[model samples]
Target: MDRVFSFQASGVCINTQHHLDALCVYFSDRDQLDSLEFYSDLEASLKSAVLLPDCVVMIASRKFCEDIKEYWSNDVLKASFVTRGERSGKPFIKYYYLYCWETSGLVEVFSHCADADVKPCFNLSICDLVQQGLYHLVKENNVVQIAPVGHLFKHPSGTRNNIFIQARELAKTEPELCFVGRSISLAFGFERFAKLSVVYIDSMGIYHFVQEALSFCKVDARIHSFHSYDEMRKLTPPPIEHLIVISASTSGGMARDLRNDQGFSDSRILTLIDKSDSDRSGKVLIALESVDKNIFDFEADNFETEIELVGEHFSSKAKPPRAVTLGRPHTPPKLLKFLKEFGRDGLNSLNEIIDGQPKVLSLVTEKVSRNKVFLKWLEEEVSWNITVAIDTVICTDDLGSIEIANTVADLISTHKVGSARPTVCVYRNVDWSSVSNATGVLVVTAVARDGGLLREISRDLRENLNSEINCPRHYLTAVGLPQSKETWSRLKQFLERNASERLYGFSEWLVLPIGSDRQSNHWSDLAALAKTSQVVEVESSVVSKSVVDASLDLVSDAIRKGFNGFLPKTDGSDLALSSGFIYFGDVFKDDLESALHATSYLAIASALQKARDIDDVANQLRSTGYESVILSPECFLRFNDNILHACILRGCRKGELDYSSSPHHSKLMGEFLLKVFSRHQLPYGAAAVEFAAALATQRLKLKKNDQERLVGKVVNSLKDEPSALLGLLLMVDLPRVSMLSIK
Candidate 1:
């Protein structure tokens, strides 16, 4: 009775183009019966090669051993080796041999290996396989020194069997520090890796092990040690990303408790063994049974999207991030109007203020008009009161919310709304002790969807965590969705009934009306506007009739197809309040209409600003018969100086808006756009422009006989500017173009 099993080999360290070409040649020569395979990137190629069955892996670099170790599961008979050439003193490469057998052709594979020139390690206790032929490194009569590395491999019992057999040179520096903790560096973006919290549970030397691993990877992050679940929870915030729990001799109940009650996502928690005594025991089975489930079966995206590199040695430096546009991409009609009234020099001065230059609006625009427009809009839309005292401002840890909160804080300071500038803190990361004595709290979020997180914040602030807060002026600022409004109302009622009779404040200027099916007519109405709108007056430039018509048509088509840039959640909507950005889905259609209108411009610019690539929007538009959107005077000047000052302030503070590096800013841009689009009424500035236009149209119709005289009088009043004169003619001619030229 002999054992027979199907065999396969997977390899890493094949990171270069040369290695790929060599591996392809080697596999082809062996008659593995495969043509050239194509992959999108090197990471994709490496992943496919690692998963392929009946494959021969030629791993060349020890740097990639950490990646290969991730594939080591319970069913696989995995062996790690430290091998050196005959003339070399120290081991040059670390090899991991992982193979699982099915009762099909194990005998034939072993026979092939025996007849072959270089044998791979089949049983670590017996022999070591030299992976030298594929890349042609071996010469005549070269004997390689191969030693079994045992401590790295963990058994089910979590005990180290070869405690006395010490390979001191390799043990201290190579196996112990190179495998487990080094994975995180290549697994995620360097920015995330830098900030991640690494907590290891009840493992001796694991702290130093992880530190050394990170040092080897050329990165650093906060690392904490914990013994029990209670001890881990005392870390202020339990690990949201990485929790390393060491498996001891006996399978502990911690894994079960973490999965069931500790609110830890499976992908965030990783279990490791510090020492394994025997390699032949039921390691994988015991792990599966003891951990209650196979811990390795976590979310695939945790490994896929987060991995910045497959091999750290060959990875290139990330490109510099592009500038983020805080406002709409297209020029607004108001900016054109401003330029017509005041020249580019005046416009430049206004921009200087938005650019965070220490300039006053006294020279830019009339204080009376600017204050009247912006202050009225702010009071109506944001519910700002000069009299109400706000003790602290607690905002969701999102870029948009933070920006809005900071702006609101500035306004409070200007008006002296409180005794001092209220302390602004992010809710999730806020220190409870810092705000324990505060009596008033204002929760500001960009958008409130179902109010789940809001409820949590409310509970913690009002009842659970800080019950002594007694201020009646607690308020919330958000763009309330259909269900969120109801949830907030219920919460308010519950708080009022259970605690005090004081009225709570919630300001949502643009609460969208919910339909029978929980869908809002807001987007639908915008779609209708896109369909009927005949003219696209952008800047003071004359846009051709066909371009405007085609732009509108494409926008209508895209709306019918659903906002293609956004992916719907389980609720059948694109916006996810948790991430504060709409998930990037498909990009089949380009939003051309955004180029001509402020509202659409704001939406598309926000969408693209949050996009993974800034040029994606521009490229898509160009392919679809529209030019790439660019910032113009109207983008900021369309609104008053005050409005632009608040939104674009951070653009100056942080140097420039780089959404790629700061994903939080991208999320914030999405949130800001969500607030803009979700509004029931147009922004105050746009609404006023439309109102004035309608009034002028009505006056012209009334004085039919005196129309020529009235027009001449208007022309005489603005005789200095010819651009404004020509814009007036095109503005009135738009209706005629849609009727005659469109047909």
Candidate 2:
């Protein structure tokens, strides 16, 4: 296996040296979209794009953010660069670049990443530095300014830092970035922009004080934030230009706080709030850069009203509003609850109960003390609902009691859901279980037999039920215990009927008992006339008849049910889910998303649960058509009543894990599945054959030297069939990297 488990095999890498000498960042003057047919507009850019093979930077746009957000459900992968280069007299360097896209192309235009607000160039305000390329690396006081267009003059900007600014003229270009009164600047205390003349103090007092403040200022300083809802409610809509409003304090609203004045709107709000609190009361929302925005939308519209409703609803739901925000899980309450609830369990393991159950249903006779025996008075037995009632019978007859128990057992049998399940009987060694159909008919009845005839049939039945099915089935025994001779006769007849139903008249089969409950250890005493329960055998080689044809008829009816369940009879207009969803994901393809897969499987289960006249849960399961090849551990744990935690372990032969452990077809499947894993960001420990295969596909990308280490780690985590695993490992060698076709 190249690698299988994500957590285990994740750390191998090949350290390759520098491939390119200079970085070649390709930036287009237009926005480019990422699409499925083409990786990006950069695909063509990559061809003639890389004049510098050592470094490559492909420009991105807002669309890059949109497409990735829509399509990526698992994890967002930061981009990587693959380079193969050689320096003269130096060994070749082969590596890939991996980093943030935030500060790449625009920054690379000049020595420093260009600020979006500073167009053309940051030093463009001065005409001399506009048309030139200059690099200055000078000391703090010994200053100099050399422009490509003019004579050397004293540098007007004076500072020892990376850039200097002597702002005494201070009033030349009007400051587009400004803050106003009582709407204090969240950072550096107050708005210091010298051109900032008009100011509004606070949004809370704005309704009462705005006109007075506006009368005093030479220029109308635009109002930024609106704090009180009542204040904003009273103000007339401002001119429909972009404007800012600190609608609420950090102590109040979510979008209120503005940590900085960089928002790009021509006018936008910089709301103040306490920086320490993590909730809405603590965070700030500031315009990165002000742009033209409809001034009426925020000032007098219902925007904040809607936001407040959602926030209140979110709080009520014990959830956070996720549309425009991220709220953390309720960790504090959960942690405290965990500690308080489990301290006792952690400190004491011995107080728990543990016991083992038996495997077969057989009868044995043993001596018992008088006090230990359970004696019942013949006449004083109370009228009780504890025992079932049907057809006006108290089940005093042996066959009738058997029929009643058998009805419940058969009900359970039909509940198979799909496959055979274990059945247990604690009293007798002859425990066994049988398949249930829609219903259980009386297999045999003492009402149908007379004397010794019923006993003979039961004798034969008791033999077959014990040896087959390995399940220690339920036993309804009657031995030395008190019972009327009529009940005894009925019991024998019940056994005879069941024996006949198990096999064809001319054939034989393995049999196991089917019982319902157990008391202490008195099985033989209740089921036998004497001590010799085992030695009392009937004709061993016997053939009993069955109603298989009738059973097959039921199955045929079930087929219609299954088909109806698979492809619902409703018009296509209301298809419960896709056809693929009904198929239990046998069609769960490599390209399918996990969310889609889960929804599909759940759809099938939901539909099955909705059928008409369906009462036998066990039989319905037995007849269910869909099956799963792999299950998430979570699914297994969550639906333990239904799914199996099945894992097939495979040991490696030489360096590759054996793939032969699973059915041969799984090998064919693994080959393609590996490619899917390589292409997506799948999680660790999911139980999918494709998961392991796909993980190997990813491992092949690790540095060659790290191959063994990564592969070894993954192997330790997986428990798969040897042959299946070996077959999966074989896929890693099946041309992992395709050679590009020379155009």
Candidate 3:
């Protein structure tokens, strides 16, 4: 058996020679340094090399597998390369690309040797390397600037510093925090405090940065944060005389509240601004000298300059006061295009295989990693496009689609595109007056089958905007679409309107078009349809079976009383509770929505009455032509109720993650959810609050702090209602309520 070791050394490499020199110093203490050899020509090295087996081979510049058009052979032992770091887009170099080579000996060795026996050489993360590189850059570069929107700290030469400028922008609109926390550590008499907590409101964008900044300042105090005033009121400790409240910007609402509620004096609180204004009358103000920008003139890049010129050109033409201005349709990146195709092909491939999620995900991750494209598109691209003004609107009705739309809107607001914030609302409920003067409109959907709903949306949108002289840029975006070309054609025709211009409309899909018509209805939509569609009288025996379960009696009773006591549906749809416990019978012929809803309810009712397992219930739903959107992690998050969430999780355990023509199969969603939540991903505002509730009640073994971090403000709003959680768990096919933790 061969013992291979892997280590990562990430830092900026000026050129090829610089990278080699860095590698030599990085591997100075390793035994492998004695036999390590570098090769630029991969083909020559593979064919001509016949040296010692102990040698660690390296190939540079091009990706090894791509250059050779094949993966490594069985004889190869180990491979290393200098590649880009995960986060930093600068001239980064990562050491040891491949820890172990594909070899016949290793395959056999793996059968006998467990993973626990083979210890890794190093455990340094890419983030650690990025920080190291940033530290080096701060020392080397005399002139640096943080991009206004992206919050990237970088050299004037455009080389990235790999440090995020979190507090400078997210907290305020005035002069951004130019100096790093370390620079400000000695300023504003911050070092005078022997022990003081740095306090601020917690947000997904600014919380981590606050801690990082405090640590960078070499402060020794505990950091305190709250999501809102309510959280602050309930959870805040009694008044601490030495506490020093801090704000990155001049905004002092949190500071003011802390003063009034916790009795912190105005002199104790500090705001990093040049001067305190009337709005921040009571707080202390601190300022640092502006850095010298003479060495690096702050000028907009060509791309930004071009966008501005285009906007000016468009504005030059005569237009109506409320006319929608057309912003240029930015071309999608090639990497994103490749991902779409890869996703489409992968989806098609999954349809032909069973239990292939692990293999499929492994393949996708490997392929993506090979190209060194770390998948954080929303954080990177979408955030970069946010505008400060209200220039766009994302319209969607599907709860899953609502999440995506909300993500886009939040990113725009978090990172001003060009100082424009986008709005997200249901197409039916969209306030025309609010969005009428907007620059662009986007119609989004989770999935589109035959394109009927899309066409309906397009027609409605066109009608709404008919009063305007010029149409703004509009796009039809979807997570998934039908595999059929005919379906796509119909959609294009509706948007294009018969051999004319595109009418300021375009279509962009997150995944490749490879969904089936059977999977058209969204799961949330199905649930809504079941809850509101006309109810028919069922036999008393059927009702008796459901009533005997005892767990669902309260829910049934609540439904009978029009959900008076229970919380209103999160989607803002009214529930017309029927007089009796209605369950659909056979011979139900209706639209796809009604059909799927009926089948889903019937399946659950049958499972409950017959005391069958979830699998049996799932099978019944699938056999009855019940199909809905394959809940992605983004979609699975739509299920606020523990019952539906458990159903989704049960589907995940069955290796069903991809879009299915039938119900109860989607392992990908589970994996995605675990990955997303593990990273503490959030959509922002009310949407994030809803998602947090779903995550909190799902019994997923998440830590208390993690749950609080996911949604600090919303958790307080959820009263200590153990009875509600207990009732929800009991009414469905889930483990006993005792096993679940009450948030």
Candidate 4:
């Protein structure tokens, strides 16, 4: 089945002795998953099997052997630790699974726990079942490809066949919210209600989103949410509004009442019935006609209040991203001009830095790709970071240069310093599935190393993958001849015949660099080019019409390189650490809130890590802000004042604070405000004036009382007006309105 999912970097390890020990045992247990023979002498059995991919021997007694399967998973490296006998004191048995592919020619071992002295007792009986040994068996069995691909599919070995089991059934499923309105604007705004109510909708997500949205606007709102019809009937239900939102299964009087009631005659209630209206509505305007807000706000926000909801949204890395703020939908010429300047460089630098205009100019002259232009524009136009972890074959030995096979197994592969990574690992030698209790996937080429397939099994998760989202593990292998200059003449013909999964497991296609002189060298050239070249952002609308740009680095390691991340370990609560922004999309769908939390943490971390580098901070936060969270001077100062010392260095003019480096972070700041305003849509005048002042790297000229008056005028302008979040932002200063008003 074709599956789509978002996954983050799960775990990372440093190349150290202690870490190696842990990994050794982790891979060894993988080797023993298939079969293990019983033995009368436990110590002798363990000593004999210690060097095998899995160490399955008894240190205590034969009773421990049967129960060992309980602990068998992709997580633990150390299989078991026990005393030699009832009389023996300290534990002597140390069994672990080590991935031998990473070891070029040296003897290696992997184990759990950081203990360093554990030794492996080698025996030939154990080696026969090793993954390296299994590759020979699979070749002999004539089921090499089909056997590994079957690992990802959930099948009852005894009874069921091809009965598809979905990941949704395994975890807590939150059905998508359905708050349909007359226009997209309303749909976008109402989503914020979910978190504010904190209503647990195991399936339907409409509960708390509504409440959270109101809170963003500093309004107190509540959700009288119900799980079932019986529960909903008990609550004093409010009159149905003209437009309402509900799940698909829920219909009947509830919807009719909303449409029939004179009060809700024109109201249109959005119901989540099918995937037809799946797109999220971004901006919304709700008319308030009654003082009885008991329907929404139990005590506050009476008839006098008008609720407006906006969303934090931006196009996919368009050039001059500010040109398309929530305020309006047209792309201004000035923005076009800025994009033209930004795109002078050709490297796709979505979230990367480029020094000196001259070098950038040279690259543009050499050549340009659409992705290169888009990435360059995004980097220059928006406060966003982009990370793309592509699978490439730098060095190939074990297979037909299937580097993606190694790359896709990153959840199971170990990163070792001063180690050579082959294009592919042994089939079962390093591949294993159904480990750690989470669905896992792997891929392999025709070349064989025994234990590769066993090493990649990782369905057993330390903590069950998040139930809120659905992501299953799958393994794909690309089958073909060697990629070389000699194969260029027949490359296209070969690819057309080989793309079929009937022969392998996944969609098999080769990525070739456009400028390449030969077709067969396409993947090689592109991979090398991506690795070393400086990426530059570009700006442009989608080639066909108005759509998100193509090179919208949705998930790239370069962007999420360094930040504290949350991982679901068996311990449950996130194993939070400074893990360089590992994103697990399988567990969490990345939304504006997650983006804010991550951006804030990264900004704070970067600031604290290099307190002296004002320039670096300025550079990292280049361009503009986001629509997800507010990052104005006031907000940033309020949230992160501890890390930011008051700007003591005076500028050339009095009252003008000057930093040793650029203090302007328009892109980053833009990202923050865009998100917050999308939900809150705060008005402007004095506070807005003050924020704009920061954007321009200037000081506010208005006095304290006057500042309040200006702020009030800006805010009151929005009191009753319904506008998009971007509309609210672009009107911040009224394009010289403040200056004219002050004059």
Candidate 5:
């Protein structure tokens, strides 16, 4: 009854290196040998061969020999085999079996058999033997089958015992594996060593399984259990970091839901199923196969292998992120400075202004011509380069006076030799316009001594030319008149007596006298006349091209300065109205062209002088209905002083003042009007009374009765004047008139 297993050589001697004693036994008809007897013989031979008591024995089995279980020892193992059975005409029945045994002596036996030269009687290799042993152990209920950490494992309810314990033991090396089952209750033994979080998505209503898992998984890991996906979705669960254990019955829906709804694309998932659900086409198998790797029938002992495979696979597939840059590396200092001064918007404006020609050229030209200081300052302090082309420079010869008819006829004959550029024909004391053939000529006539020159020039340009003139004709004038002491004394006396006399009419006849005292008296009289006259002109009586050129230089300088000031502040299209002087001359017609240019400096000087005596000027204007007129320095040079003065006075009386379309000029006129009204005394008339009353009401925000009383007082004050009766009639209301007995 004692069984023995024998290892014998089959006469196939193979030479091999060896360090231990080797024994081989020949076997004939090995299938007929008794299993227990063979095992006993093998053990005895192993002992005789000086092998350790730990020697192992292997048996090849052709069937599932249940009777051999009684004789099986720890030192005995079974190699796998296949047997076929034929029953009449029915299909053959095939059976496969494998088994293994392990003890303290197993390693010793393996070590002693390391270098045997004889071939073994069995046909199984070492790999075959190990696989067969593992297969047999998995088939038997002695060792529980465990799945890989991230895979589904199924077993019968009876065979679920010791599964968690084996998994915990495996977790010692590969900590990711933790087990939960109803039959086996094992606390998370890894709790003291490491912490983890387990999310059990229990769609199958496996509440008992969840409770058991939570209880057994006593590690620092937190176990969250939800019966349905909707319940789980209510709370924002942390990312599934450690593992997600789902029942195989619901694994497909759970996986799909987790991916589609919860955005769980990368969570490690484990599934649990029953042994009866082993159909490959089952939901559990399909779900497991759909994932990155299918981990089925995973043993706790292979936990490290499973984790390593998953770690390598995921690590290989991981992706990481990218980077960026900005702006220019370097900027020039000059460019930075420009940006700081003008800014990007301002620079664009400046570019536009430069592209458009400016409008204030003529006014600037006139202002520069009269002032010697401005002329000098322009030449030296303010650097300006200019080019001048003079077609003619007519001077007063020793002949005393030039005849208008002959001079024009001779100039016309000479100009017959036509030139490419336009001719600027200059003349003095002559009616140049009477010459009918003066086509393509820009005539600049000096009208200071010619009484009819201005009238004739106007007539010719307006009527005689027939629009044949290619360029505009202008009248040039000197800035101021010279005066002798005796003449200044006489003029001063005349002005003192007749304050409203047209002063510019006689200004040309006076000369600054030879003596220093006479010169002082001459200037004094001129200043006196300037303060008294409604309109006055001061001129140099020195008309020449040099003066014109100097005037132009100052004008250019003013324009440059104005542009420099405005460019940084404005967008090119619109500039400040106050700065209109910079482009004032560009808008002029030929009528005032020369006058405006010639008198610009003098007008500015006179304006400055009036500014200095602004209080006195304002008082005088307010007392009388008088406007302080500062004519251009050359105003008398081009037009008869008396006629010009009369025209201006008439314009003012009619409430007509021309600003030549210049805002700066318009502003100046407004300031003059304000000064004139600053302290105006009401005249004795209904209009004056009403004006006073309205002004008071407006200033004080007065009511009806208060305003009427004020008006009555004003009217009473003017009762002696002829217009006061009209004032009273206009002032009284019907009720008040009845009380006053006015008919």
Candidate 6:
């Protein structure tokens, strides 16, 4: 065997060149320096030194020597030497160390023989050394004979502390092991070896630190950490062959229990007790079935020495078994059934799935509003705590849509009594911008003339609303309400032709005659349908008075029941009715102006009655002699009718209320008109007289035959107002009397 030697330089400071020179002299040949590998970077020759063919030499630091002694002791020998170097450019002496080993033990064992006898010794091998007990081969061609520089026969502290080394040795044959402790140091030592499957059990609190330390060291091992024994028990144990119990005190019972109860019966158990404990023994004796085992104290021994012993023992044992696989246990049938019934497939089964999993049923049916079946089911099967049902109604007409929307909105707002059973939301037209992105049921009502419009709305909802709504069980429904049979037929054809392709592309569409006698039945069906639906959508024409009224009635009923209410469109039919009044007034002029005045007066009276303060203000004004200021019925009707007509015209031209102009002015004008109309009523004769005067005024602008025809109609309307008709005829002849001057 080829002999190798290692030298460790230890001092405050040492010179590389001087050490090399001294080494050359000691070896008696300058070429022997070629075998040295130096640790310093100062000398190029030393830095680049290569090993000799026969012997290998290395110069390293004391720390490196200690490390080598710990791990590679079987392959290396260590010793120390003192040398001289320059301190501040003067001569200084320092201690240098060395570690050496024989590459081939045969040559060293037979070195006393001459060159001629060297060939005979070539037949000798490492097996012969092991039998002689003069040397031991840790592995093939690796011999360890020399005692390390600081080898301990017994712990100086009188405690047998060699568990780390013993544990490491055991690990070589049993790579799968369990460690029961909170000692970070033990984990650090254990992580150094690769291909280890280690289960580390500690109190829950320190598991984080252990994981952090392992991460810091970049440990590559199969490691499972648990905070409690129960947590550890939950895991399928790897094929454990060793158990290391590290504790602050000697607890042999823990080790024995882990070995017997944790399916680690075949595993070897090792205990390492901390030295600081009062009951700790120098060498703990554990009672086993077959023998008394000795547990070691780990604090009294040097960590590196222990490591060396373990490394030697590891090299001597057979390779560890392959890692054990940990797999998930089979799930119970009951749990599997519950998961299957509560998952995506179950939702399609609808109410049937709610039979067994009542908790899941609660999640779907809780707070359901307007859906009677769901509410009734909840009341009977679940809890009466299901207090409110929310219904969403949408009006989808372009004409008079806002008025219907406002009416529905107002009804919903006012109908909310304390804790009503159901609440409702009426969206005039679907304002995609205002829709919430929250996950829930959405009911959409779309009223469109053609299937193309319905399809467009559906596409918009899909693009803007569907993906944004995160609720898994949500549904979308569209309802079409047509006024007449012709319209209903046209709508039905459009829906049938394009529903699947367009309307049903996103949701289901239903067509119903809203103004028909079955309106209540349709709503009742809808309420029941809502129970099964996550979202409910009803599409109806805003212009359909029956549809609007029916939607409002449903919302009102819900509110009256004291349910939670949400109405986005919260104004009465004032806008629509007022607009209608204006339309009729413009067409009929003075002839129907009295009727429009009566409607406006009634609206004001209704508003006053609802708002007591406003009513009181009106009462106070009447009591202050304001009634004396009231104008005659004809003049009052003409003046306010002109204001109403102008306001309507402004709204028609601009498509919105001009609060700063006509509408605002009309409001103030209405207050005055209300005061007059409240105090007096226009009789049929006065209305007819006003109509005749208005016709007479228009006759002045017509041709000869047109004037005669207009006079005939005025005479017929004023049969009981001959005096008023004569006054109108007189006024018609006055070329200077302008119609505008009448007001």
TM-score of candidate 1 on Cα atoms, chains taken together: 0.22
Write down the TM-score for model 6. 0.16
Which scores greater on TM-score, model 1 or model 5?
1
Quote the positional error of residue 21 for candidate 5 in Å.
Answer: 28
lDDT of 2 at 105: 16
Candidate 6, residue 743: the lDDT equals 10
Q: Across residues 690-727, which tens digit of lDDT does each residue of candidate 6 receive?
A: 22222232311223333433443333332332232233
Point out the higher-scoring one by lDDT: 2 or 6.
6
> What is candidate 1's CA lDDT for residue 9?
25
Local distance difference test values of all predictions, in order: 0.33, 0.24, 0.33, 0.25, 0.28, 0.27
Provide TM-scores for the models: 0.22, 0.16, 0.21, 0.18, 0.16, 0.16
Number of clashes in every candidate structure?
10, 91, 17, 145, 39, 36
Cα displacement (angstroms), candidate 3, residue 242, comes to 2.8
Which digits, one per residue and each the tens of the lDDT, describe model 3 over residues 1-743? 11111122343322331322122111111122112232322323323323211112231112222322233321242233211112243222222332211111001111111122333322223223322322332323422223322222222223232222223342221111212232233333444443455454333344443444455445656666554446656644445424443433323555666678776566665543321234563443332122222422243443321101110011111110110111111111222343333322222221122233211111122233122232255446443432234356655564546665666676666666356456677877878777666666666554454567677876776666545545554554543333334466667666657233535455554433322323222222222322421232212211232322332333233233321111223232321222111122222223222322222222222222122111333222121111121223443444333223333332231112222221222233334433333332222121221222233234232333333232322222322322222123232212222132334
Better of 2 and 5 by TM-score: 5
Off by over 4 Å in 5: 1-195, 203-218, 239-242, 273-743
Candidate closest to the true structure, highest TM-score: 1
Cand. 2 Cα-lDDT: 0.24
Sort order, TM-score high to low? 1, 3, 4, 5, 6, 2
Candidate 4 lDDT: 0.25
Q: Give one digit per residue, the lDDT tens place, for model 4 in 1-743.
A: 10101111111122222211111111111123222221222334334342322223211112222334334342332222233321244333234333221111112333332224644433222221221221222123232111111111111111111111111111121111111111112233343332233221212344343433343334444334454434444433244221244432211333343344423332234442211222323111221111112221222212221111111111212111111111111112122222232222322221122232111011121222123443344233212211112121121233322333434333222332333332333433432232222222233332111213322222221133344323232222232212222242243333223222432112222211111112222122222322322242222111111111121121122112211221111112221222222221122233322322223222232232122222332222223222111113333333322112111100012222212121233434444333332323232111221232232223322332333344334334433332221122222333342333311
Per-model root-mean-square deviation over C-alphas: 28.0, 35.0, 28.9, 27.9, 43.6, 37.6
Q: Distance from true position, residue 50, model 3, in Å?
A: 49
Scored by lDDT, model 5 comes in at 0.28
Task: Please give the lDDT score at residue 333 for candidate 1.
Answer: 21
